[model samples]
Target: MMNSLDISEECNNAFDKILKTRRSIRFFRDEIPPKELIEDIINAGLFAPYAGLAVENKEYFRKFIVIPRNTRAMEKIVEITKNIMKVKSEAFKSEMDKNPYLKKKGAAFSKRLELFADKGVLGIGTAPYYIVIAEKRGFPPVQQQSLAHCLENMWLKATSLNLGFHLVSATAQMAEDEDFSRILGIKSGEYEINGCAIGYPKENPSESSRPETKEVINWIK
Candidate 1:
């Protein structure tokens, strides 16, 4: 049997590998990951930090609604999301046009918006599963932050599972859409929503770079 120090070193090495290897993958194969593995990924998110005090209801504070590809619900959410993005993209363009700084800084973003507005988010249909996460709204409406934490957990879990994951960020703006909210069995604006697409990657992911830990850390007095 391994000693305690050896066990600790082994865990540290495994963690470092996963943290360094995690990268956002866009292109995915049509093949689906096992349902059991997907459930494990969702479970990873469910245990993520939540606003215990800020939650209006403790019981239904968080929900994971998984929609499989090529289904009517998937079709409906994609349509609803596209409609939402189309409106947001137009407004974003108008804002960018009027602001010189914004126009310059958001050029790449504007291109992405154009594609999303026209065809919907890329990974939604390409991946076999579109997972929607909903966090109930509360006093300060800090649900979005909690939703973000949940997604990050799911993202890391997916990376560890050798699954490609894409953030469907546009779904964050779908809160006020009554049609979209109804599909999730929640009233409009009652909950903050976010989504992600997950599947097997078509190709191996390239290495992702980041600043050295020492460079980012602030050893303040």
Candidate 2:
């Protein structure tokens, strides 16, 4: 019979496999994942790290908005995201002009910003579902950190289920947009938001490379 040590080793190995297999999947099949499966992933997100004492509302602190592909809602969000990226791109350009070294070193990033400002991300509508996860702003203002934890949990859950996942990071900057804020039924700046796309992949991409554990880990005595 397997002992407790054997069970612990098995669990650790399973989790390691899940972590190593996670990838940022951009292209996806058109088929929509079952509603229950999506809920399971979102449910995983709720269990992530949160500042329980920071917010008074225990019942409705975090929110998730799920939109299907090719819908009017998706259209509005895509347009809003593009506009926000445009503002971000312009701000970066202004900074680049002010600093000669910044302009030189930021050339590649500027190109990426231009792409976002112009066309937005194709994965927004390519995936069967676009999910916006919003965290309620609190006194300490650690909402973004909480949202990051929430997303990582959801991403890992999706990976374990063989679903594709992509981060729509521009959604974080749209909190102050009047039109986008209205869609969430919250006042501007009331929430810190992040978004992601999830669905089955069209083709499996290889896992991303990572530095050796010894290369990055630091120990303090």
Per-model TM-score on C-alpha atoms: 0.88, 0.88
Model 1 regions more than 4 Å off: 1-7, 97-101
Residue-level lDDT of model 1, residues 59-137, one tens digit each, is 7789888888898888887788788888888998999989999898998888888888789887666689888899888
Off by over 4 Å in 2: 1-8
RMSD of each: 3.1, 3.1
User: Tens-digit lDDT track for model 2 on 1-221?
Assistant: 87656668678898898999999998888788999989999999998989876666577889998888989988887888788889889999999999999888998888888898899866666689988888888878889889999999999999999999988887787888999888767778878999899999999978768999899988988
How many clashing pairs does model 1 include?
0
Clash count per candidate:
0, 0
State the local distance difference test value for candidate 1: 0.85
CA lDDT, every model vs. true structure = 0.85, 0.87
